[model samples]
Target chain A: GAGVSQSPRYKVAKRGQDVALRCDPISGHVSLFWYQQALGQGPEFLTYFQNEAQLDKSGLPSDRFFAERPEGSVSTLKIQRTQQEDSAVYLCASSSHIDSPLHFGNGTRLTVT
Target chain B: SQKIEQNSEALNIQEGKTATLTCNYTNYSPAYLQWYRQDPGRGPVFLLLIRENEKEKRKERLKVTFDTTLKQSLFHITASQPADSATYLCALFKYGGSQGNLIFGKGTKLSVKP
Candidate 1:
């Protein structure tokens, strides 16, 4: 794809279940970001990866949230013991560098029942 | 605590009119501010960015003004069309912050009716 791509446009999981969302950034992009967007709210930063290095994960809300980009091309966000509050859209974005405008994926909507 | 705020209410305007949205931040001055447009069920698309030193920036039909003293930014869309309707978000990044530390406002939804 020409732009960032995310998998599993929609997912439903029962409370206490685990879920993993994937993101494929634009090839060669050096910066990738994960964000969570709740209903009627803006996307909140979750974690950021520079190439293969995970430089910042301060935005992750809880210890249950984890993300990784092993090869710097594809990334995954894993949520363990999901709760109803975890239901939201997970957005993935990439940029050529830290300061460049971001290209965003359509996002994956997760619903925890 | 740092906070970013955008108008919680939606704005409705007629086509051919201009629409304005407001974003305000408190406790910290960001090095740069950016505006993005998001349609329903879609991720936000980048629009414009203005640095702290720059007072204003413009594109084809969009203009953004940043006021450091007031800690606010205004986004304007001139000659609005129905196609321009969307939720507009303002994000802030401070210098020396991590690359993905951008903080976003809740966003203001704009509706342009023909």
Candidate 2:
């Protein structure tokens, strides 16, 4: 891909509904990251993967938030029992290496009603 | 706990003037800091990065300075243009944390009027 690509650019979910956001990172990107951005706020870290390994999940806010990168090229972030607080932009980023600058996707705007 | 802070207030400047944005951090010493430009409804694009040991860095009209002693960084855009109007963010890698986990400030919005 030319850059990181995310699907379902906008999502509206009801309370208690489950939603999944997908990210297709640049070809051969070695690292992937997920972030959550609230209105008027900077993106906050959610999770990270190096290749197929889930190296970090410490940033996830709660148990309802889950992310996976099975094949290491595409990733998915799933939220279960969504709440109003979950309404925000879900951002996906990828990098060639640990210290490289990240390339970001436009992100999926999730609105939990 | 590590914390990053950017001026919450918006900055307005006339075109052709230099626009400077500040970022400060507390309770952590980052090895590197990065600057990003974000437009409304879009993801942030990487702009620049300065290491703790480097006093300053420049890329065309963009200059970034890092002062580890003061835990501060300044991003300046020389000859600012209205196209530069956007929220500027500062981020750092969390020490002892995930390599890809970056701590970001809320960001400062800069508006350049022609």
Candidate 3:
């Protein structure tokens, strides 16, 4: 793909249900990041990966949030035991290098009802 | 913890004029500052980036100025068009704590009217 791509543009899961969000970073891009944007707010960083190595997962809200970028290409963010607060737009962005500008996907809108 | 902030209010300007948005931060030194434009219901698109050593950067009609001393960044759009209407976000790449992850501000909405 020309840019970052995310699967399941929209996901509505019942409270307590588990959901998985996928992100496909640009080919050959070495850096990937995941962010969560609540309505009316800017994106908050959740995790970052540099070629399948999770460098930072400190921004993750809780233990229920887990992200993996296995093989350094595709990444998945799994939310276990989802709650109403988990409802937000999940954004994936990638960059060729640490200082390069990021290219973002449209983002997956997750709603936990 | 470091924090980034942008003017929460929306900015309105006439077409062909210029618009300026501000980003402020504290508690951490940033290596670079980035500006992005985000339309409703969409992800942010990169505009311009300025490193701490550089005072300003320009891309066509878009200009950005970074002042590490002031801990602020200004985003300017010259000869603004209606197509330029969007929420403008600012971010910084911090070296410590989280290396590659960016810290973003809330963003300011810009309305360029024709």
lDDT of 3 at A4: 89
Off by over 4 Å in 3: none
True contacts kept of 1: 0.68
Better of 1 and 2 by TM-score: 2
What are the lDDT scores of the predictions, listed in order? Answer: 0.93, 0.92, 0.91
Q: Assess each model's interface with DockQ, reporting 2 decimals per model.
A: 0.73, 0.69, 0.71
Q: Which has the greatest lDDT?
A: 1
Winner on DockQ (2 vs 3):
3
Report how far off residue A56 is in candidate 2 (Å): 0.9
Instruction: Please provide, for model 3 over B1-114, each residue's C-alpha lDDT reduced to its tens digit, 9 standing for 90 to 100.
Output: 788889666899999999989999998878898898899878899988899999999999989999889999999999999999999999988666563558888889899999
> How well does candidate 3 reproduce the true complex, by DockQ?
0.71
Residue A100 in model 2: lDDT: 82
Model 1: per-residue lDDT, tens digit, B1-114?
A: 569889665999999999999999998798899999999999999999999999999999999999999999999999999999999999998855753758888999999999
> How many clashing residue pairs, candidate 1?
0
Worst 10 residues of 3 chain B by lDDT: B93-102
Candidate 3 lDDT over A1-113, as tens digits, reads 88889989999999999999999999999999999998778889999999999998988999999999879999999999999999999999999997799999999999999
CAPRI quality of model 3: medium
Residue range A5-82, candidate 2, lDDT tens digits: 999999999999999999999999999999999988999999999999999898999999999999999999999999
**TM-score of model 2 (CA atoms):** 0.97
